[model samples]
Target: MSDAMIKVALIGNPNTGKTSLFNHLTGLNQKVGNYPGITVDKKTGICKLSKTQKATILDLPGTYSLNASSADEKITIDTLNDATNEFSPDVAVVVTDVEQLKRNLLVFTQVKDLEIPTLLVINMADRMQSRGISLNIPQLEADLNTKIIVISSKLQTGIDDLKEAIISYTSLSTERCISAGKIENNTITHPELLTSLSAIELKKVQHRETIIRYQFINAALKKSYKIDRSKASDLQAKLDRIFTHKIFGYVIFGVLLLLIFQVIFEWSSVPMEFIDGAFGSLADWTKETLPEGMFTNLLAEGIIAGLGGIVIFIPQIAFLFLFIAILEESGYMSRVVFLMDKIMRRFGLSGKSVVPLISGAACAIPAIMATRNIESWKERLITILVTPFITCSARLPVYAILIALVIPSERVFWIFNWQGITLMALYIIGFAMALLSAYILHKTLKIESKSYFVVEMPKYKVPLFKNVAFTVIEKTKTFVFEAGKIILAISIILWVLASVGVNEKFDNADAIITESVSKNGFNEIQEVSLNNKVIRFKQSLADEASEAGKTITAQEINSAIAEKTPEFRQAVIDDEISALRLENSALGTIGKAIEPAIKPLGYDWKIGIALVSSFAAREVFIGTLATIYSVGSEGDDEEANTIKAKMESEVHASSGKKVFTFASGISLLLFYAFAMQCMSTLAIVKRETNGWKWPMVQLFGMTAIAYVAGLIAYQLLK
Candidate 1:
């Protein structure tokens, strides 16, 4: 935790158990952030090297070699090359698989050539014995000219020994294993020098360097380590036969996906309803306890409502990462990639792209960054462009509410539910669109780049509860805190727009109500209640605001009406007045103006306004509707129902039917599925693409598709 701590860079190839070691060392202390100049993620944590001594560890993106291929690999190369860089480690930990020792050494030798002390960690050591692998530790250490520590990241052994080596790093040599004498010291010392070569010569040098490094490693490993290839290969082949079978593998993948979606969809709702009510009650309590003023109003209407929209989705976020943890811990995702490679190849995407594509289900920002290992610019570009089309958690709120409106809440065959099926369908649609679009781009772009996809299939194990728990916590916190800030800001801006009007009618609501009540010659009781409501409205808009102990509430209004006349009749009259007031308000007028644009999609003006507000972020759609409804609502009953209920109750002015029809609901669902409704996603894309060009294409292009799709669905359904 102190500033004097030693910094360690943990580098490894994909599937090397690096993340497991990191989690064991850092526990819950890790923080994920972007490197200053790039969108590539930098994961840093403080690990206690000794009781009093701490070491800062940065888990660089996993890459197979020091030679850069993608944006993320450049980060590793940049950090490793710069001795003066902030994250440049005093020592580096090169974690590699013992079974694939020869292949892993390519990266190790490259790191050693950087002239930094490097500790070699042979992880997954527990599997070594069962797989009939053995190492001559002392000879291997001497031959490699560096310390080697064998550890089981799964069993948590040899970590202390690794720490010991890290502390004694000062005694380790900084000599290059493969001599860099032919290359200039400046080029060797700094990473950027590699970029100086032209394409042909650069490829030649990179190819030669790999050959030399492997030759050296093969020489070192002679008589030092042995593996029973038959035993290892037999187990992998046995599992691969069934799991990667053309028909059975796909069936298994499909069934597993259905289980996850169904479980998440069903179990998350219990917590979601509780969270929704808790926030709604909190807002009501705040309005009731705090003295009536703009501050209280903002707290109840703006901040609380904004925060509620996000917190309700925490269960969905938790389920997403939980399932991810299961796949990663069980080692099934790697095999899935292996099985899908052929199909993905036809779309001009590597199996490596599958990781980013699946992750796109949770969020696209880091998912796009995950494509760094794809090793092909054309494939990577296609992956990035189409990733946003995948349904992200941001669209979950929109989908959930809209689905509830159209799809019934009923179980299918006592095992499946209509709601769960719809949710899964959306995910499938997104992935389908991503692949279809990738294929189209492949045919059109005509760009070429190098492609390599070599992956390790780790032994399967039961998912550890601790690992799954941490993943859920980290991802859930990320969604709530990071995305929550944006929601809060947007909510405040929406409050101003929805609450106030542009003209005298919007401004003088109380006066307008007063004039109507007086001119209509209401009975004595109705007159008093009408005057009281106008007074309260005037008090709410006072230039010099103050705390008012007595406030008129919808419940109290209901009670007053019940005492004087039929409550239903009073509700109708009040609804008419409230509707009239909002019609003249600025937000309502804006909605009406845009009604024509969305009319074809089966949405009225109010839905149009919500759609426009949510253009910056889809989660804001429900909150936008809630805010508008709250602004125009006069009856106390509106507060009792959830946003889903309030929206369901909405009636079309011209048709007198519910606004949220089957046609409209399906149309909205389709629109949000394909639309680039999140500005943050676009901003990240712009940064990732190094310009606004691709982001602009994503925004306009995706929205155009969304519009057409929605129009078609509504037309067919209506």
Candidate 2:
């Protein structure tokens, strides 16, 4: 081994346990990013090959072979071919399933021809005997001209041997598995042959090359691979029959979804409430403890409040990813894609589109990137365009807040709450709308292309707990830190906007409120509420005195009440000043400007501000509202300053009705469900489409639909 680190590339076809091996090697060391100039995911991690030698492992996208049929495979080919590529490996580990050794060897041979130091890793060796599979590792090594290691990634066996092989990669053979001249063509095996060929001619050549490679693989496997027909089990087939059944499959998936949503709500409620209250108290304590200053105000009212809106939803987001990870790791998500294929085809999509669409539930950026596997340009474009409408984790924050505020928490049947049912409904609606939009685009778009869908059904296994935990942690962190950055920046900007104003009213708010209160006292509603509070205070004091066996006269009671009444009035005056000041501030001006535009949809100026600010990301809606409501709220009752509490207490300026009424909450939910609010999604769409034309359509076109839908819903409900 050299003093410098080794670069090892992990390559394999989909569902070959490649990810499991990567996780086993890297543990928590891996970081996900994008390829240098592409949207495809680049996962890299460090592995300790030995005490003295560490290797950088790059897990390339899963591809069947290096035929360059799709973007993902193109990436694999491009990396292996270009030595100067940063991620190009010093050694390549070709992972193959023990059961599918022959087919997996196709790519192994392709990598061998690239003249890289390559080795084969036959994964899932633990299942070999049960599946009636056996491998001649020594014979296969000699036949393929590469070192072979058989291991089960799930069982974590033979990993040390694989590490040792990687450490000694310098000794691995660079010989080709099959000679290029052996491709059986009349044309000479010269470099000029490829240069003179057109793309169509090149494709034909590639196809012929694949055929030759498979033939060689078959001959090699005939001597090295064997299967016992009598020992194999039919369990996989039996499960597949039931899981892929048309009616039962849909029912199972639906029931699973319902259960997931129910758990998300019920399991997360306690933590969410705790986080909400904790943040509220922290903000209050910050204001009380820190010397009164603009910095303290920003830290409490702006940053803390804004982040709390998102942080409180961590439990629910984690639960969402937990279920998604389990389904994926258990090999069930593939069955879902298979089951959805018929309906997808009816909507002008193929089963291949289902992965990206379902993945959109996590985030649209990666989901759109997943469209790289869709072979047809038209289908890929449609998947990319409509994917944002599929309710993502970002929308979960918005939906959770609105549903909690508006929907009754009463249980449906005996298990599901109305809130959970509403969340599930929104998800279903999002997916339905995506398919409907795809159907419309299929009829409208003039792009002509032909494509077919092929899905691999991997053998089912119990999901590894370690893998599930890693996924949940990684995905949840991504959501938090990514959204946290946007929220933090916007919160600071919004705080300044809400804190400073050029208007005289904002500057004179304290004096103006004091004088107004002096002249008119409290309003009828305010006075009545204040009097009730005073009565309760006096009665409590009298009861306490009686309990002490001391007589309290009416005059003494009146004197104590008088002292507390002034403090109570002062609180009211300070609160009034805070409200007046915020209403006249810069944010308020902007909000008021847009109020008329949104008012018809049952929103006030504050919600209008939140709506506009949330364009950076959908989850920002909650954070934006949290920041706005927290502005100048220091004088508010400490127990009443939680984001939900503030919103619940809010009333229309003139109408005096609650702001977050049932009608408005539903309208808001519908808007976020359909709106193209995420800038990141738009950027990814632009890059994926290679132009701005489609992304622009998504921005304006989807927003228009959202506006109309919200308008109709609010009107009918209100």
On lDDT, the candidate that comes out on top is 2
**Candidate 2 lDDT (Cα, 0 to 1):** 0.87
What C-alpha lDDT do the candidate models reach, one value each? 0.78, 0.87
Tens-digit lDDT track of model 2 for 334-422: 89998899999998899989999999999999999999767688999999999999999999999998999999999878998898899
lDDT of each residue in 1-718, candidate 1, tens digit only: 3437888999989889998999988999999999987888889998988877888999999988877767777888888888788999989999999877878888888888888999999998888766667799999988888999999998899999998888888888888887766444233355564777777776666765675666677667765877543345456555766787888899998878887878887888888888877777777778879998877877787788777777777887788788988998888888888888878998988887888887887888888888755556788888899998888878888888788778997998787888888888988888888889899999999786756565556777899999889888988898778767777777777677766666777666666665775678554444444444444444443422335545566666555555645443454456555566677777788888999999999999888887898877778887777766655344433234356656766777665667899998999998998998887888888887899999998889899999999999999999
Model 2: which ten-residue window has the lowest total lDDT?
185-194
lDDT of 1 at 630: 56
Q: What is the lDDT of residue 574 in candidate 1?
A: 65
Residue 470 shift from truth in candidate 2, angstroms: 0.8
What is the TM-score of each predicted model, taking all chains together? 0.67, 0.70
Which portions of model 2 show Cα errors greater than 4 Å? 1-233, 524-568, 635-638
Residue 509 lDDT, candidate 2, scale 0-100: 94
